[model samples]
Target: MYRLVLLVLLALPLAGCFAPRAEDTARNWRPMGANGLALGRLVALSPGVTRATWEAFAGIKGQTVVRLAAEYDPVRAAAGCPPPEAGMVRAARSFLIVDLAVTPQKSVDFIAAKAQAYSADGYFEEYDLDIGVIAALAARARPMPCADLALPGYLR
Candidate 1:
């Protein structure tokens, strides 16, 4: 019985190795409780003004907001813009509260054309979005980290 107990203890550590690594799991991670809808990966497709308006709309719709930013060193780096900064890195402690919605390709195309015609620096952020769209996206937003929000059992 003692030998059996010792073997069980030894096997317990090995059991962990069979489980997926955190990074591996994160790669496949989808926001929990999003039903069939999913938030697209955030990209730097537009400028700051657009981001601000989108954030305002997102607030009204109660979507999960991840204010993300990055720093870029145009020339040889200085003290503030240190090394290992070849590309964008998440900006220091900045976040914009914003609504997120998926725009239909048709709408996106139309807006792009209009911007080109008018020679606008960029288009209004929420030009293609509405409250209903924001709500839909919000419904699928992953629960904010470390906050309990009456989530579904699976998510909890």
Candidate 2:
């Protein structure tokens, strides 16, 4: 039971990351590490992909996730980021698979919000290089406070 509760707590933040607004599609400019705080990175789509695949890839970091988000790293993107020397790659792949399976298909706004969140800190700018591929799964259909999801009367 403790593990289950812990898992849910961990999931809440990830869950919050998937909220969306209606006008999100119109605003395409992605936010990247604004105001400073090395956290995440985003690689936008030259050709956008499906929601399922996109959700599977968002907010990538930490010991277990096993993925990297390098919006600034050109060489790494081209390299296809070969797995590390020992077992890190396997561990990352396993965690990613689990994340993909668990996250549901969310709105485009959710995806955009995630992009913004990366910018909220310094996540996007931190990554050294990530260009060319748009992303492996660099977005989450996340919600924003300024977006439609929040009610003006209650929120403000």
User: What are the TM-scores, per candidate, against the unseen true structure?
Assistant: 0.18, 0.18
Q: Per-residue lDDT tens digits of candidate 1, residues 74-109?
A: 121122233423332322222222322212210110
Q: Measured by C-alpha RMSD in angstroms, how accurate is candidate 1?
A: 19.4
Which window of ten consecutive residues has the lowest lDDT sum in model 1? 109-118
Question: Please, what are the lDDT tens digits per residue for candidate 2 over residues 43-141?
Answer: 233112112222223342311111222122222222333433332121100111111111223212122212211222222211111221223333332
**lDDT scores of the candidates, listed in order:** 0.25, 0.25
List candidate 2 segments past 4 Å from native. 1-26, 30-79, 91-156
Residue 73 local lDDT, model 2? 21
